[model samples]
Target chain A: MSRLNIAPTKSNQLNLKRSLKMTSEGFALLEQKREILVMELMRLLDRVKVVQQELAQRRHKAYATLRKAASHNGYYHMRNIANGINYEHDVHSDTRVVAGIRIPTLSVKQGAFRSQYGFADTDSLVDQTMIDFLALLESAGKLAELETAVWLLARELKKTQRRVNALEHIFIPNYKDTLRYIGEVLEGKDLDSFFTMKMVKKRLAEAAEAAEAAEQAQLSDGDAPDTTP
Target chain B: MGFHIIGDADTVLGYRFAGLSGDVVETAEEARVAFKAAIANHRKGVLLITEAVEDMLADDVTAHRLSSKPPYLAVMQDIWGPRGKRRSLQELIYEAVGIRIVQDN
Candidate 1:
């Protein structure tokens, strides 16, 4: 019956050491990537805040203008006028890839509001109001487009950040420690072998010297044994 | 669960999800209708909206926020021009973590 042995060979030891070094190097690179990503994320966030505030103000102004227009014409009349106006709607959709992320795009046709009544009969104020409303709508549309981009980017950034953190704090450190442990163990084994070889050589030299001294004493005794002979 | 997306015609087209109901609302009234429908459906986990549409229906958005059954609403900006002006998850982190760093400068 053969018993199982579980000792790592020289080649396995070398490979382990190499792997550990590679993991540590990889971890260092990953750390740098994480830092850069975090910085980018921060900047993007600051811009988002600024944009959010601007959007809020713009929306408020647009709403105020719309409300004033509605009051002047009466809500029902304004609705009727808007209903009579012809608007042509067209939309185009596309996709763009950014940093391995696929983002959708839309191209919308800007609607032109044309009055059913003749321009001559229509009040200039109503026409101006319509134009203002359209402008506001366009602004709102643009803001929506911007917001969509911001939100999607934010989501992606968050996911990337999480991954970076995991690599930095957990995986890299564990691999590095394991590598260090293996190296230390190998170094210790080398030192122990060197000490054992020196001790063995010293013991053999002492034994040889003792044997020579004893041989010389015996030979001298034999040479001086003439009376006994 | 039903999801309603409100935005510009362009925005609505961009966010076409399989099970989501979408409305390309230019006016406040249409925005209101979409908002009501979103609230009624209650099954939507997320309400993806454009800032432009949110502007038109700020009041409705606020009302949804105050409601008990409000879904997770994510507002984003359009990415079209050079600057890439929009909201992102990174922005949320800055808001949540309160750490601000400027990388562009």
Candidate 2:
């Protein structure tokens, strides 16, 4: 493992341990953030699915009605209808943040689609078709909001995943290795000094014992009688 | 703000009856400029871009989808619209152009 290039000193050891602790804590915080974001994303995914299904049905109806209108009268008449009548829908939107990402909330507010084509000349089917399209427009607003929300959440989810991966796979592992290397070196020095102290103490004890024995032998042998006389 | 219609003259005209104000552009380049102006305009609440121009300026439209602010882009689809159930090129062209070019003998 590639350890950080630095002196293997006690201060270095302390520094490494401190940094390792901080990194691990940071990693934990990020992991939590990722988990929360993922949960939020899954919830939003469910919403998107439901709205999408509804939107599909509405869209089918809209297109079907449009085709009916075209066939019932004439393509020109259908074109004139759009050219004759106008429907202005006001959309009120706001933003709310989820996991630090801002998403839009939309509501379509419209009263009715007015007809400029005279009621005297048009068939009721044409009016019904117009109504269907207006309803589709309202649903389309919800579809847009939901779809946009999913996009924003999905993008944020990708970013959170990247951060989590960096901490788990790269930074955390590197710090752990550096801390382990420093710990091993410090332990090796401690063992070495321990053995050296043991050896010095043993040698000093043996020298004292030998001196005591020599004094005892001289006294016992009465070598040169007592110097008191 | 006002919605934008960036497509053929007819599609833009269809929206005009609704009293909705928008731009009718011929080229994708012009549409892009018009789209930018619409997004920047504070009064623009919703944009009703037709499917034709939306297809041409796909990237710009997608980028606009990510915008957190106002002027929500809504791609309006008429009777003849893009993107639906699959059809062979021959069938697609026949349906779009209504010309019986490909005849099975």
Candidate 3:
């Protein structure tokens, strides 16, 4: 009744079959992609955990050291020296692809160590705390990288899942139904052709039987002398 | 390009010695206000927040930290000492990655 069934031809059915095969293949590829992305996300998540732990440990250590520096040198004196020193951290990122998702890869570089203040002004504890903070900053850079990668891959995973669902739930089954419908229509046409041929053969046979009977009656009447009106 | 420090008066004052100037939020509402200002800052590349202020603005800080690209947020322990339970970061990690961790004493 609809254009979908209008053509019910072998070629059309073959075309649909090919399309179904292609869609199935595409669904499989997408599923594989999703699996790979999920794996990468998990690995990155583990890396992030390790980095977080390191960051926290370094933070507490740094704060403790800073506290020691403050107590040993007096708060005002420590602040005075801290205000004078400057440390610059540089960061740049490049894109890394995981399962076809581009995620950023960040690299942090801290400038050369410079204690602008006189060596006697800041205690060794203060110097140690600054180094620890630098370490914490480096770890923070790593966290940012992993977090971004995990989130980006997770986003791609969601998209791949949606496509897989559509192919599995809707497209494949609908194509199957159309294939069945077309097959039924084709079989019905074949049956109609067989019935038409049978009717035509039966009519021809009846006509030939009538001709033979007429010919036999003429022959018998001629041989037996005339009979009846 | 630089860092912003947000904490109580003492923490802010201490970090200012390191030349980090930021909002001093002593209350939850003030924490939210300070977070908005800190996030809107394009010049600052990192936010140094005292753990106490961070705990007060827990939900807001988490939202902003995850959503923003720059001004990488680093929660630092207050020189005064940690306040409350110190599981905020751990809990956030669990939420993000669903990993259950065992802390060593």
Candidate 4:
């Protein structure tokens, strides 16, 4: 079998070493990225779960209040009361950024509660009820928005999680295994070449010793006449 | 092309997407066909393929890494269980951002 020459030139060896180092660095970076994504995802998930639970509760309370008011005050009266409640001075909204995600902040204007039905003599149940209902409705809307946000965020989190897992478990491992294989092959070649060189040197030495011995034997065989003289 | 789901018969049927069809793609050949069709439709922005299908079509997926069009394929672990705790996405994030964010729980 023709022996394979495995001694790469200095430049090629340098390139290979550099590539191996680069691959290692790349793997490290991928690992770090996975960690960051997971942490962020987990944090967001916690917030999402809390919001989800709170939203559900708020929705339940709002439905219950609406039901109670309807049963006691009648649907027509509730509608009229809702119309007579002036929210023009009460509702407010603002925006804030959280981890690059924009979310709206809602607040109710203080001291703006008043009845449009001129029920000053009797406490205006309609006005109070309408305000409460509107507040609940606002909370419900916010909850719906939060639900959507949570679902979308969860989907994104899951996607990122999979990607991280892929790099960590599959891509990096495969690349590393291939690199190790190449390294082993190269090392094996080096050892084989070293052994071949050692054998060739030993053979050359043996050949020289044989040549010297043959010369000495020839001289001994021809020296009989010289010894008699 | 719209989003399509591929997995075991039961798994595929469990996925619900409006107007999207989920089909059980058992072999590499079937996955390749479905993947190509999803790409051709031009309307699909994402293709969620099962991890099993992904493993079968690994070569095909790698071959198309240079494409810049839509139908960005994403592999999901089987809903039944994870194949394994593969590389965390945190690693990819670190690759992009150069910081460790996912810590031990």
Q: What 10-residue stretch in candidate 3 chain A is worst by lDDT?
A: A1-10
Better of 3 and 4 by lDDT: 3
CAPRI band for model 4: incorrect
Residues A1-229, model 4: lDDT tens digits: 1222334444455555676577667667655654654565556456546654554464354445455655576766554444433333232434454434443333433334345565643243443444554443333334323332333333444555566676567655654555455566678889999999999999999999999899888888689678977
- Give a tens-digit lDDT track for model 2, residues B26-65: 7988988888888787343667777777777889887877
Stretches off by above 4 angstroms in model 1 are: A1-58, A84-86, A91-97, A104-108, A116-126, A199-229, B1-93, B96-98, B101-105
User: With candidate 1 superimposed using the best TM-score fit, by how many Å does residue A51's alpha carbon deviate from the native?
Assistant: 6.3
Off by over 4 Å in 3: A1-15, A67-82, A117-125, A200-229, B1-105
Q: Could you give me the TM-score of model 3 versus the true structure?
A: 0.65
Q: Pick by DockQ: which candidate is best?
A: 3
Top-TM-score candidate index: 2
| DockQ, all candidates in order | 0.09, 0.16, 0.18, 0.03
In model 1 chain A, which range of ten residues has the least summed lDDT?
A: A1-10
**Candidate 1 lDDT by residue in tens digits, A160-199:** 6666666667655655555556566678888999999999
Candidate order by lDDT, decreasing, is: 3, 2, 1, 4
Best candidate per lDDT, number?
Answer: 3
Q: Mind giving the per-residue lDDT tens digits that candidate 3 earns over A129-221?
A: 667666666665676566555545555666787898898888888788888898899899999999999999998898888888888887887
Query: Order of all candidates by DockQ, from best down to worst?
Result: 3, 2, 1, 4
Q: lDDT by residue for model 2 over A1-229, one digit each (tens)?
A: 6667888889987887888788788888877876776676656656656765666677677667656666787877766666666655677788888767888888767756766678876787677777775666566567667656666666666677788788788877877788788788889999999999999899888888888898988886676567645
